[model samples]
Target: MDQRAAIPVTLPRDNPTQSYWQLEPDEIADLRSTSSLPDKADTVIIGSGITGAAVAFNLLSNGARDVVMLEARQACSGATGRNGGHTKAASYRSFLGHQKDHGTAMAAKIARMELANIRAVHAFARDHGIKCDSTPCDTVDVVYEAAQWELDQKAVKAMQDAMPDDDAAKYTLHSREDVWEKFFCGRGGDESVCGGVSYEAGSLSAYQFGVGVLKLCLAKGLNLHTNTPALNLEKLEGGGWKVETPRGVITAGKVVLATNGYTASVWKRFQGVIVPLRGHVTAQRPGLDMPKEGLPGTYSFIYEGGYDYMIPRPKGSKFEGDIVIGGALAKAPADGLEEYGTTDDTAFNEVIMKSLDECLRKYFGDNWGADNSEGRIRKSWTGIMGFSPDGFPFVGEMPGEKDLWVSTSFQGHGMVLCWMCARALVTMMGDGDEKELDAWFPEIFKINEQRLRLTFRGRLS
Candidate 1:
């Protein structure tokens, strides 16, 4: 059997491993607008994560009424809730590859879009007073390998040259000594520390942000149904689609699939194109010797094969000073190949868990000190992320499928991509001017016949 087809990318599983962000359930966590499923709607959105919330927000805010959203589990209980909450976009890491494939102008556009998306998210939160602890801070990418550090320097310089002068000014490079003294408290040596790059980034409670957005949409008369999985989709003869769910079927003029990792489950055409990859995360208490106020900002420890990203809980928050870290794919079996094409988030890999436990101790050295009363890790969990054959996400309408749209395959960078992607998608759905969207959104993200062919070929090969 083909390995990709053999792995099941089913619907979101029940009783998923608890994530640190979802500990305090929101009021709309299990919201069901009506006693039964609605028979019809102007628009139906599958998957109630950030993408779904953003799509509903855009639709309702633009005078589109009768929009319904469906969730397989509790609202915001997918990757958005389980991820390490950082709106940091490490675009430089892929700048060289993007430029080589698409060209300098497109690469620069991609980087700018990411930064703009981060700002939009923060601005939206502040404007709505959605108290999700959204904070803007400087995020650093600390290099641990000399060779990788050199490559990153070149990538950053190339990105800076391609981007606008104002955008380029946000990045700053540091020497190994500066990194050691500033970030590591003068701990790491030559072998462990190799310079760093700092840029404007942010950290927030994604679950809270998503739920808050949903609450606003609900106030505007958006219908939400939790624990309502979209089992399948069928095309209507005259127009629109019939979305089949366990409870009932909804005939909507438009159907929007915001399902990320489990998209293939309902849309079989994306089976191989959008592979599901399981990711792990942990919330750890700062050691006794660590600073009571926690580290200054968010961080990413970059090495040769993989990188680990982290964010500290806000000082006045309940889990103040606690570090939320994730990504140890290099240490996982087969360098994370074992995690691909899997949608199970109920359990985690022991090898990755062990590496996560040792991560802070290794980086902070003796200053990490002994564990607290509750030990190092307060909670650990897994989430499923959708990965496209190419790094870019698949947005806009599906070819040959009228009224059916999609905004998924975020490749675990949903924080920096979903909001804007959702906005652009809604614009296209409403027949808004494409040239206006073209000014900010990347054209490569649009779904076309050529992209679909290439994606299918790449998956099979």
Candidate 2:
């Protein structure tokens, strides 16, 4: 496929590979608030993942009635349901690059916002008593290359130097010896392991959290329609929009596209800008000789061109001690370029599965003894993520598009950016205090003609 070409994205495929995190569907998974689609609504949100859930929750909590949400598949079954179950923000890894592209202040602002977003997600889950198995824990980025390890040290230092002491203290650099002793006790002095950095992070069932929020919104008079994809959008001359769907059409005063990877399918302007990339993940049972209590915390095995992230299922849960691992793009064909611009998730690449299987044995060595009776690998699946050329989400209203708003292109870091981005977009839609938003939200995330033009030029060049 010519990625630069303006090819319209396809809708979510039916019978997608079953995700480990979604093995047990939520009660609201196939929910339809009413028997029939409403003729009109005050607000219509496209997509029913975390972004849409956050937007609807904020709108309803603020007394906005007549809100309707549309989902293309089972509710919360998109990227939010198929991700590796992490709420981590490895901001230091991108500190220098962000500082060079944006200014020091803007870079610092983005880092802080990411941290704040993680805290907000946990707080909401806790405050609402959402039983998503949310857990606060430390995360380690284990570096494999010496050169990359050196760069990581400098980036961490730069990030710390730019932030306040309290926030800076959240990150700590660890030597190879330290990583082996503290986290990977079974590695047995692997010379290939360089070092690592640890920081505050978390893990939770994103599907559960999103469904909990949507349940709250439903109680607040919000309408939700699942298995109903928005096929096309028409703008009314008098104001509002006409959202065409397979079931029926719904006219709304305002429309919000939280579609992420599927955004280009409905909005032609985002065709090349918000490119779709397929990612694979798996749930594996620990070896018989491995630690029965599970690993210490969330981890990212960082290498030259790609990384694999893992999060342990909470202790005492049905799948306790099982590790949810994902990302082996480097081993895939063309370094995974074959995944770009694809929306199908019905199947996953066998190469990625083989790479993940080998990775476990390579990293764990002897500790990863023989597989148990149940087998080592439990399940594998694929999900699509939206990639922005500029590495920032497009928030706020689309340039020159009246009453139409967007909060997509999270670049696979939606867990750390979606909540706040959705909140900021809704605040702007409600004509809330602009000064307050300016003080907290990163200005770089807002949509503007300059960003649109730059991305278009890069794609067509």
**Scored by CA lDDT, what does every candidate get?**
0.87, 0.86
Winner by lDDT: 1
Candidate 2, residues 1-461, lDDT tens digits: the string is: 35532556788889999988789898889999999999999999999999999999999988899999999999999999889879998998888888998888888888889889989999999999988889888999889988999999998888877776847336888888887777763374345888889999999988888989899899999899999999999999999899999998999999999999889898888888888878899889887887776777899988877899998888856688888899888888777767778888998788987898768777766667788788888988999888776888999998888989999988889999999999999999996999999998999999988887655322110
* Ten contiguous residues minimizing lDDT sum, candidate 2: 452-461
- The C-alpha stretches of model 2 lying farther than 4 A from their native spots are 1-7, 185-190, 456-461
Off by over 4 Å in 1: 185-191, 455-461
Candidate 1: deviation at residue 389, Å? 0.4
Q: What is the lDDT of residue 3 in candidate 2?
A: 57
Model 2 steric clash total: 0
RMSD of 2: 2.2
Q: What is the Cα-based lDDT of residue 49 in candidate 2?
A: 92
True lDDT of residue 355, candidate 2: 91
